[model samples]
Target: MNAAPADQIRLLDVQALDVRLSQLAHKRKSLPEHAEIDSLTKDLLQLRDLLVAAQTQESDTAREQTKAEQDVDQVRQRAVRDQQRLDSGAVSSPKDLENLQREIVSLAKRQGDLEDIVLDVMERRESLQERVGELTERVTSVQAKADIATARRDSATQELDDEAAAATKEREAVSAVIPADLLKLYEKLRVQQGGVGAARLFQRRCEGCQLELNITEVNAVRAAPRDTVMRCENCRRILVRTPESGL
Candidate 1:
C-alpha cells in the first residue's frame, strides 16, 4: 500500500517503539526471578512433603520409645517386689526359699533385657527427631527464598510493564498521524515478519533482513515516486528509503 515518504519514516518510528515495547514484555516474562521463583516454589512443596513424612515417622518412633520405657518400668517393678520379698524373709521353707532366689535371678535378667530394648528405641527416636528438626529448618529457609524471589519477580514485572505502557502511549501518538490503511497493513505485516513491519534501507542494505538489494531492486526503488510505499524484496517488510539508502 502507498503512503507518503514522510509517513513511511513515521511508520518506522512507530515500529521501533513497538519493538522496544515487545522486548520489554519479553524481558518481563523471561526474568531470572521468575524462573527462580518457580523453581524454589516447587522445591518448597517437595520439602514440605518430606517434612510431613519425617514428622510422622518421628511421632511413630516416639510412641515406640514410650511403650518400650513402660515395658522396662513394669519389669523393674516386678523385680523390686521380688527383692523385697527375699529381704523380708517371707518364704519360710527351704524349697520355697530356693525357688524365690531363682525367681529373683530370672526377674533381674528380664529387667536387663527390657532396659536394652528401651535404649534401642530411644536412640532411634532421637535420630528421627533430629532429622525432623533439620527438615523443618530447611523448609523455613526455602520458603523465605521463595517469598523473596516472588517479590523480586513482581517488582521487575511492574517496572517492565510501566515502561511498555509509556512506550505504547508514545507509539499511539506516532501512529495517529499515519494513514489508517497503512497502519492496518503494517500491523498485519508486523505479525508476518516476526515483529518487524517497517525497516530503513540503510546504505543499500535492507536492515530488517540484513540483505543488500540487487541492482534491479535498487533501481526500481530509486525510480519509484516518493509518495509510493516500498517493500524489501528479500524479506517482504515495509522498506523506508532515506538519503543514506544508497539507492
Candidate 2:
C-alpha cells in the first residue's frame, strides 16, 4: 500500500496527543492533594487510637472511684456497728470495755484513711474525665479534617479520571488518522525511549528533550525525504518538521 503524505502529519498529531496524555497522567499521580490525603488518613488513625486509650483510662478511673466509694461505705457501716456496741454496754468486763474503746479508735482511724483515699480517687477520676473530654474533642477535630481530605482526594481522582477518559478519546481519534506502519513504529519507539517516541523539530531543536540538533544531524534530517520518518540524533525522538523548521 502506498503511504499517504498526510500519514506523517497525522502521526505527529498522534504523538502530540500521547505526550499530552502522559503529562496529564503524571500530574494526576503526583498531585500534592493525594499525599496530603494519605497523611491525613494516617493522622486520623492515630487520633482514633488516642481516643480509644483515653476512653479506656476514663473507664478504669470510673471503676476505681466506684470501688473507693464502696470501701468508704463499708468503713462507715463498721463504725455504726461499733457505736451500737458501745451504747449497749455489751462489754461488761473492764478489759473488754477497754478493748472495745481501742477498737472504736482503730475503726475511726481506718475510716479516716479510707475517706482520704476516696477523696484522692475522686480527684483522679475528675482529671481522667477531663482528659477523656479533651481527647474526644481532638478526635472530633481530626475526623473532620480527615473527611475534608478524603473529599478532596476523591475530587482530584475524579477529575483525573475524567481528563484521562477525554485524552483517551482524543488519542483514539488521532490514532485512526495515522497509518498502521507509522503507528507501529511510534509504539516501538515509545517503548524504547521511555514513553516518548516523537517530537517536533523546531529551529534545529528537538521538542521532546529540548536539545539542539548538531549541524550534521540537522542537515541529514533536512535532506531526508519528507515522507520518511526522521529521528533526532541527540534524543532519538521521531522528529516532525513543520513549515517553520527551516528544513
Candidate 3:
C-alpha cells in the first residue's frame, strides 16, 4: 500500500483522535458515581425489605390488639349481668348467690388479663410503627442520594458523548481525503494492532511498538521512496516517516 507523505502525516492526526476517544470512553465507564450508585442501590433494597417486614408486623399486632380488646369487653359484659342477678335476689339459694359472686370475680380477673394482653400488643405495634417510619425516612434519604449520583453520572456521560461526537466528525473529515486503498489498509492494521494502525518513525524508533529500528532497517527505510507506505518489522504496523525520523 502507498500514500503520499502528507497523507501519512494526516493519518497520525486520525490516530490521535482515536486515542482521545478511547480515553474518553474509559473515563465515562470509570466515573466514581457508578460505584456510588451501585452501593446506594444495595442499601435501598435492604431498607425496603426491612420496611416491609415492619409494616407487616405492625398490621398483625393491630389485629391481635383488637382481638384482645374484644375479649376484655365480652368478659366485662358477663360480669355486669352476674352482678345484676345477685342484686335482684334472682338466685334465691345462699349457695347459688355465693357461686354467682364467685363467677363475677372470675370474669373480672379474665377481663383484666385480656386488657393486659391488649396493652402488650399495643406496645409492640407502636414499636413496629416507629421502626417502619424510620426505615421509610432512610429509604427516602438514600433514594435522594442515588438520584443525585445518577444525575451526575448522566451529566458526565453526556459531556463525554458530545466530545466523542465532535472527534468522530473531525475523524470523518480527516479520513475522507486519504486514498481509499491506503485508508482501507490502515483500518485493517488498526483492527489487528490494538487501535494503533500507523506510527511515526522518530529518531530511528517506531512509535507504535516503541522499538528502535536497527541499522539495516534504518538503511532500508532511508532508501525507500517518499510515497511508499512501510510497515514496522517489530509490530507489523504502518510505519510513517517524518523529517525527525533520524534515517
Candidate 4:
C-alpha cells in the first residue's frame, strides 16, 4: 500500500488504541468480581430454599400443636362430666356404678395421654421456631453478600466500558487520518495475522515476532522507499521502522 510515512505513523496509533480496547474487554470479562457475584447468587438461592423449608416446618408444627390442645380440652371435659354423674348417684345399680367408675378412669388416662402429646408438640414447635430464625439470618447474610458482589461487578464493568469507549474513539480518530486503501490493507492483514498486522521494527528486530532481521534484509529495508509498506520476513506483519532500528 502507498501510504505516506506520516500516515503509517498515525496508523500505529490506531493499532495501539485497538490493542488497548481489546485488553479492556478482556479485563471486563475476567474480573474477579464476576466470579464472586456468581458464587454469591448461588448461595442466595440455596439459602432462600432453606428459609422456605424452615418456615413450612414451623407452620406444620404450630398446626399440630393447635390440634393437640383441642383434643386435650375435649377429653378433659368428657372426664369431668363422667365424674359428676358418678358422684350424683345417677346410676343406682351397683354394676352400673362400677361401669361408670371404670369409664371415668379410662377418660382420665386418655386426657393425660393427650396432654403429653400436646406438650411434645409444643416442644417440637419451639425447636422449629429456632431453626426458622437461624435460616432467616443465613438468608439475610447471603443476600447482603450478593448485593455487595453485584455492586463490585457493576463498578468493574463500568470502568472497563468507559475505557473501551475512549479507546474506540481514539482509534477512530487515528484511523481517519490514514488513507482508506491503507486502512483496508491493514484490516485484511490483521485478520490473517491474528489481529496483529502492524508493529514497530527496533534494533533490527520485528517487534511483532521478536525476531532479528538478517544483515541483507536490514540493509534492504533501510534502502526501501519510505512511503512503501514493508513486511517482516518471519511473521509477515507490516514493519514500521524507527530510529532505533539498525535498518
Best by TM-score: 3
Error of 1 at 244 (Å): 2.8
Model 4 lDDT tens row, 104-181: 889889989999999999999899899889988988888888888888889889988988888888888888888998
**Residue 114 CA displacement from its true place in model 3, Å:** 0.7
* Model 4 CA lDDT for position 173: 82
Q: Distance (Å) between predicted and true CA of 155, model 2?
A: 0.9
Model 3 over residues 115-170: C-alpha lDDT tens digits? 88988999999999999999999999999999999999999999999999999999
Query: Ten consecutive residues with minimal summed lDDT in candidate 2?
Result: 1-10
**Cα lDDT, all candidates:** 0.90, 0.81, 0.93, 0.86
TM-score of each: 0.86, 0.88, 0.94, 0.93
Compared with the true structure, the alpha-carbon lDDT of candidate 3 equals 0.93
Q: How would you encode candidate 1's per-residue C-alpha lDDT over 122-177 as one tens digit per residue?
A: 88888888989999999999989988888888888888888999999999899999
Model 1: which residue pairs collide? none
**Whole-model lDDT for model 2 versus the true structure?**
0.81
- List ranges where model 1 is wrong by over 4 Å: 84-97
